[model samples]
Target: MAQLAQSITPVDAVVSRMRALDATLPERDGVAVFNRVYLAVTEEVDRHLDAGAFPDPEAAITLDVRFAERYLRVAEQGCPPACWRPLLQFRRHPGVRPLQFALAGINAHIGHDLALAVVDACRTLGCEPADLEDEFDRVGDLLISMEERIREDLMPGPDLLQIADPLTHLLGSWSLERARDATWSAARALWALRGLPDLAEEFCDRLDAAVGFAGRMLLTPLPD
Candidate 1:
């Protein structure tokens, strides 16, 4: 337990792991698409930590590492939560746009994994979600800031027919702000349910399935 805690406690090690993923994963793969987005966020968090932006840097590191580890674990184990299954299943579909892949991955991570990550951090630190609110909001803000860039960088070019693209409409339907807000609520609810283990597990499972449904929608393969 001590070694496991130590492994994920350092921001540098987490960033290194992400960089390694970026190096190894194929560019067009769905997991790779999400990894790039997540890697950028992790790198930004590292910068913020260096600049003393987080009031509780250790808590922040714990949350970030714990959150990322969930995703990495899924990749290694091939036993992802419901929220991530769609993205993984559709990763290689040529019809799924890069933008769709990125958004679906974000949906799974933010919608499902993030709530559980909050609970994981609280358990690790022997604290509560309220204690990590500042860090949560800060990390969320970084993710929100990156959403625009993700679209701009990944979206199909503005060719004549692309103006009326279905991907454009699909992308518009989901908002990072909404996802972040929902995650906060889910985190708080999960924390409240911590005393009731069975209930909390059921809630988490439901959340995972709901997020997976959304991911499936996001990955609706559009004709090229």
Candidate 2:
């Protein structure tokens, strides 16, 4: 295990962990639903990296690894942040649709974890968020595409798109594009406050709680 860990790239290792989760988790499990979506996004990003798509593949790799590690850490831990609590708590709730599960996970990761991961990658790479702008935007673009695909694949058909449908409201409430923009701002804010550990920690805590609240809303139960 030690030798294998040393040889494996961070992205590869994270992808492996996600795959393991996919294999073990049941198809209807909420976390598994999100895991499947995330695994696809990660693989797509990996392919981009291999194709030399990013202007700074090293920085992109570092950012991607750090970003994935945040999610994996919360998943492996006994206690995760508020942003992850909803999904973990409702992983098997029958009323929550698969689309809800997937989007809630995206909300938490993009709204909360992504910002912190940006700061983490910055510290590791010894560069500012601006230095990672190209890689960040590229990754964000991929995520946007993933989000679009998720909606298409998971969203109910036109028959279910009535004005009274709860899913319609839920979908309208959260926007990945907006979340991506906010995450960039949050990342820059976090980088600025890096010198003040207390303030930074407080900011993160608030962000986590806020994102968690949003996740909880996204996972709202609907009638069968």
Candidate 3:
């Protein structure tokens, strides 16, 4: 069994870990509870991959990438960077580093196009003019961050072939399936909540983009 490096402590585990410590809940406070659940789910996903419990490794990689990209879109565009900081910190896990490598490889192929698409989608949504600039800011930040991390941190030795191959393999596995599930969930989440009809359409469009990207991993050439 591989020793796990990072994990969200279970509620029971936390209480046990702080056996002698006293803790109290604040009035109507749900933040701590939500935080614990979020961490637990993240660790569960990591451990699921670590344990090889996913039905297919190849599909898992694609799904993971799609989900991560979708997440980055939300983080850098919709949510404040500070809201994303903690999740980004999860990249410290070794399992996560490879996922970033895989993401970089995918972005190299479609980064510019998808980014422009996202920006266009923002306009269709009639986002505040300030928000349009914010999205661009987020995009620039991501590009810079990716450049710095891939070189200075993630892979000390540049081995594109090694990085790309495993990720490709994993994308063909169950990851893609999970990726599909995520998009479908996105469609569900956007129902009437996004406010703008055009924006909601674009939201589903992006979700379909995710699904279509995953389907490409199917290997059989589809003729136009």
Residue-level lDDT of model 2, residues 57-105, one tens digit each, is: 7788899999998888876664788999999999999889999999999
- How far off is residue 97 in model 3, in Å? 7.9
Q: What is the C-alpha RMSD of each candidate to the true structure, in Å?
A: 3.4, 3.9, 18.3
TM-score of 2: 0.93
Error of 1 at 93 (Å): 0.3
Q: Evaluate model 1: give its TM-score.
A: 0.93
TM per model?
Answer: 0.93, 0.93, 0.26
Query: Could you tell me the lDDT of residue 124 within candidate 2?
Result: 92
Measured on C-alpha atoms, candidate 1 has an lDDT of 0.88
lDDT-wise, the better of 1 and 3 is 1
Q: Write the per-residue lDDT of candidate 1 for residues 1-224, one digit (tens) a residue.
A: 12133233477887788888889889999999888888889989988877777878888889999998998888766888899999999999999988899999999999999999999999999998999999999999999888999989888676734643777888889998999999999999999998999999899989999999999999998886
Arranged by TM-score with the best first, the candidates are: 1, 2, 3
